[model samples]
Target: MSSPEHKQKIWKMIKDIKVGMLVTLDNGVPRARPMHLVQDEYDGTLWFFTRRSAEKVFETAGDQDVCLSFSDQEEGVYVSLSGKADLTDDRELIEKYWNPFIAAWFHDGKDDPDVALLEIKVQMGEHWKAKESKTFQLYEIAKANVKKDATPNLGENEKFGG
Candidate 1:
């Protein structure tokens, strides 16, 4: 409906943004992969079901900082969340979200010793619009020709008639 309402919905979508792309660094670059995940409403924690032996799991083994992104087709919106990812070899959760399809990956079994879960806690995020009919080029154009201005630091204009 309105701009604020749209933004609100984008924020709320985190609750249903089932799958998010996890971006990690290999050798000081970027790598993107998709993952099905659950979301925490109050504190914005993203839960993902994955295998402990997966490449992603290994990448985060030494690093906790990461980026989680979620988007949907219903609306032209997307959210890129930057946060820390904690890897746990928890067997219980591994069996919880396991399905028959996953048997292909874990020959050892769904509750195999290598299966695990990745818990990502979001810190701060940026939301953007993605249109199917037309690419999101508005921000790109404005951003390209954008002008920079310097402003006074905070509290500079906070003197209350003293």
Candidate 2:
């Protein structure tokens, strides 16, 4: 696990890597999909979007135990957010983070029947060697050489952007 300072840097890296590839299991089969996260300040909820018919929708249904992976290629930082997924159609939340680009996903834009929200309540995660523990230039050399297991262990229910 990382020291307090390193943990802070990892949090920031997670915030930067907002777009995660969510991994789920469907009938004992594994699946991965790229997802965009919307940070909610009200309840500190993590919000994501997807189509109703997507495979993830089915997999995340019976059980939301899933993994969200984010990485920074340049900085060599990786984060894995493991959590349980939940489906919701919260109108207020949809309106709060609604973007015009989302229109393409919904015929009703904000009211599309096929649109649904996937909320991942974080459990625990792992983060790679970030720059906080070393000089900005030297961290990469050290991190690249470190083994995956030795990188860092981030414990349960950690939040980012605050």
Report every candidate's CA lDDT: 0.63, 0.70
TM-scores for every predicted model = 0.63, 0.71
**Which residue pairs come into collision in candidate 1?**
none
> Candidate 2 at residue 62, lDDT?
70
Clashing pairs in 2: 64-85
- TM-score, cand. 1 vs. native: 0.63
- Cα lDDT tens digits, model 1, 1-162, are 124444345457665766778998776678889887543333445667677668887778767779877776566557777778888766665666567666666688865666777887666666655433334344444555564453322111110100
List candidate 1 stretches off by more than 4 Å: 1-11, 15-17, 38-42, 99-107, 129-162
lDDT of 2 by residue, 38-63 (tens): 66331324678777878788888877
Best by TM-score: 2
